[model samples]
Target: MVLETSSTAEASIRAPADEAAAERDLARRAQRGDPSAYAQLVRGNQGRILRHLLNLTGSRDEALELSQEVFLKAWEALPSWRPEARFHTWLYRIASNVAYDLLRRRQLVSFEPLPPDHDTPAETDSPEVRLHAKQTIGQLDAALARLPPEQREIVLLREVEGLSYEELAAALAIDEGTVKSRLARGRAALAQIYTRMQT
Candidate 1:
């Protein structure tokens, strides 16, 4: 279920309208209680959603649990879904809410620094390269962890999840202008953090 980010970006750029149409059709069928349609939706999206949650929470176990909750919530709410929003956007909204709720409940929780299995280096990588990669990821994780929840969410959705500005606005219940502003601020903050870490 490890989705290639390049594929996601290519797909998003290639035929968003066609993809939306297909998702809408599946959603309609799922709303009508088509188990196969729902399963297909889950299979297609689970990896992306889990990756986003992992980036947000920095914990694979929490991400996995929250992802299951997200799909379940999506299923229960499927009947009321309107096709005005893309299916992935709607699911992202749900996932964001779930992550935010968890963050609120466990305020200031300490996340482990890049769990072993979360993003392992390739076996072919030299030890020095692997160490460098791990250190970079750790710095990035620390920077993300320090961001305000809203800013962090925006950054992850835009940068890590490769969500379009429109999708981010819909998923976060913000306007596109707001998405741009927040993304700018988030990136700036992250840059500052990285610079400080480097020093």
Candidate 2:
């Protein structure tokens, strides 16, 4: 006699806990040697991790390889993970270490614009508009490249990754005040560079 709505059905199928709680539960399961739970966690985080690495390394190939390494390291260290810390933040700390090590070893200075992930009107617009968009992206990449690695990393994590100051601190093993100052300086430097490029 009762017809269930789609939303109600979805609600029933989904967990009652919030997303953070759900992630914690998954982390606990993963720590218990549940491959499926670990796989789910990887799937949830892989895209953001890949995009972040791509921006940091400036190469799609390097990003792909580094993403695999990050997951491998994460899985290996999962047993030591503390439940008090956020799972994603812990993973991010690992990722930051991996990336910074590679950057330092290579003394990498080259950079490329991130590949467009969205289909925007610019893509369908006139050739001139598309060209302008491409130039802007390139300019942005050049500006980012000019920043010191620390500032660039903080800027990307804060702006591109949308991580909070506290999250950035945790990920980079720095204090929240440091994160804020670095982000502010990075923004100011980036603005100066971008403005010069515009002129």
**Which has the greatest lDDT?**
1
* Candidates' C-alpha lDDT: 0.86, 0.83
Which 10-residue window in model 1 sums to the lowest lDDT?
108-117
TM-score of 2: 0.84
TM-score per model over all chains: 0.87, 0.84
Q: Model 2 over residues 1-199: C-alpha lDDT tens digits?
A: 1456877777766753366788899999999999999999999999989878887887788888999999999999998898877788888888778888888889876555555542233556899888777777777888887887788888988888788887788888889998988899999999998899888
Q: How accurate is candidate 2 locally (lDDT)?
A: 0.83
**For this target, which candidate reaches the highest TM-score against the unseen true structure?**
1
lDDT of 1 by residue, 91-142 (tens): 9999988987887788855444546566767889999999988888878888
